[model samples]
Target: MSISASPKSRLLITHVLDFNSIFLFKAQVSRQSLGVLRDMKAAIYPITRPTIGRKKIPFRPYNTFPSGLKAEVVTFDE
Candidate 1:
């Protein structure tokens, strides 16, 4: 997937399948990118509930850094 703010700025994403069967995603920012891409700061929110009939859903803050990547596996019991 590729996300772009303009013709010169873009975030390129590539997916790789490892030998362990885990999917790894890699992202690269173009050299001419500006703003958020240049700063490399992003907020990610994971939805824990269904939003079918909800008017508002709380956002859980997840921080991302340029130094490294973090991955989490969550399981819910019904």
Candidate 2:
């Protein structure tokens, strides 16, 4: 299953909590689509860490792979 977000949705997802929602959404969709045995992918904008004061704290979850998935992040030439 391929997941995509619109520009408006992407804007809302920039927040830390909203970004975390993406993971939940992914997991739910994966479960529902399991019967089809389709590959799961999200076509969202590159995720940037939110800032606290002048420093950008890391979003550690972004560095790890999703559970039960053998996936990799691929970048394209811009």
Candidate 3:
């Protein structure tokens, strides 16, 4: 899909591997389409859990990925 296309036009990424806490994904888009793949950095925070009223705390596992790509985390490192 073209870069100008909407988010839905993004290629499907079925596999996502957390390489030593860094997320790396493979897209359905062929290499010939984009020529070269670039690594993207992003933040992936943990889900916040409810708690008593007090100072708020940040989450962990802040990961990143390419923008405008549609992917599913089929498997990941623990």
Candidate 4:
């Protein structure tokens, strides 16, 4: 499952959170997709924090998506 941001871009949902009637989902996307989401004012956040030994690595949300890859969405049953 995917949401089309444009004729050439798409967001693949990887995780889903359901709260009563509202749904929150996660996606691994490209910088282009990130920009699109930002333009749409979607709530964009880093999915994880990286740490090396005692130092916390800086988080860059755009790095989450691997290069040359697309994503898929997940559906759940109530």
Candidate 5:
């Protein structure tokens, strides 16, 4: 399964964690769909720093996003 980001979602890409997420994400994304991020200076970062849950759970297990891509939320482009 691929992880996709969209304006409809409240979650945003903070960093890249792994290759699996990136490959799956890219696989699901089409050439036309990539225009939205590529031209917007999207970037990937890792999430292994353990910053989730607002640091409320110090002992919580955090998965690393070795390949998370960030994109701009463009409106009226459709």
Candidate 6:
């Protein structure tokens, strides 16, 4: 099977055969492939969940100024 030029980071056939969670291992995959063990569990390798930081980053104002006086622009990377 062949994959197109799409850059999705989901699992592909190659990843499923041998799973590795270490970022370095996953890096070897092409853009279209995903972490082999992402969906399944195995005895040799434990499935790990992404650790969510329960404590939020302390919010500090980057720059405080009069709202009206500042020229503002916003962009969403999403």
What TM-score goes with each of the models?
0.18, 0.15, 0.15, 0.17, 0.16, 0.18
> What local lDDT score does residue 15 receive in model 2, on the 0 to 100 scale?
56
For 17-59, candidate 3 gives per-residue lDDT tens digits of 4332332333343333333224222113232222222111122
RMSD list, candidates in order: 17.8, 16.8, 17.9, 17.3, 15.7, 16.7
Error of 2 at 75 (Å): 25
Q: Which segments of candidate 6 are over 4 A away from where they belong? A: 1-34, 37-44, 55-78
Name the regions of candidate 1 deviating beyond 4 angstroms. 1-20, 36-78
Question: Candidate 1 residues 1-78, lDDT tens each?
Answer: 446332222122333532222222223333334344445453133222221211111122323322222322111111
Candidate that would win on lDDT: 4
Model 2 misses residue 35 by how many Å?
17
Once fitted onto the true fold, the runs of candidate 3 whose alpha carbons sit more than 4 angstroms away are 1-27, 36-72, 75-78
* Clashing residue pairs for model 4: none
TM-score preference between candidates 2 and 6, better one: 6
lDDT of 4 at 47: 31
lDDT of each: 0.27, 0.27, 0.28, 0.32, 0.27, 0.26
Candidates ranked by TM-score: 6, 1, 4, 5, 2, 3
lDDT of 4 at 53: 19
Q: How many residue pairs clash in each candidate?
A: 0, 0, 2, 0, 13, 1
Give lDDT tens digits, candidate 5, residues 1-78: 235442222233223543232111111233334553566443353222211211111111224222212221222122
State residue 45's C-alpha deviation in candidate 6, in Å: 2.6
Query: What's model 4's TM-score?
Result: 0.17
Displacement of residue 58 (Cα, Å) in model 3 is 24
lDDT string, candidate 2, 1-78, tens digits: 234421111111135564333321111122323423353352243333322112122334665534312232121111
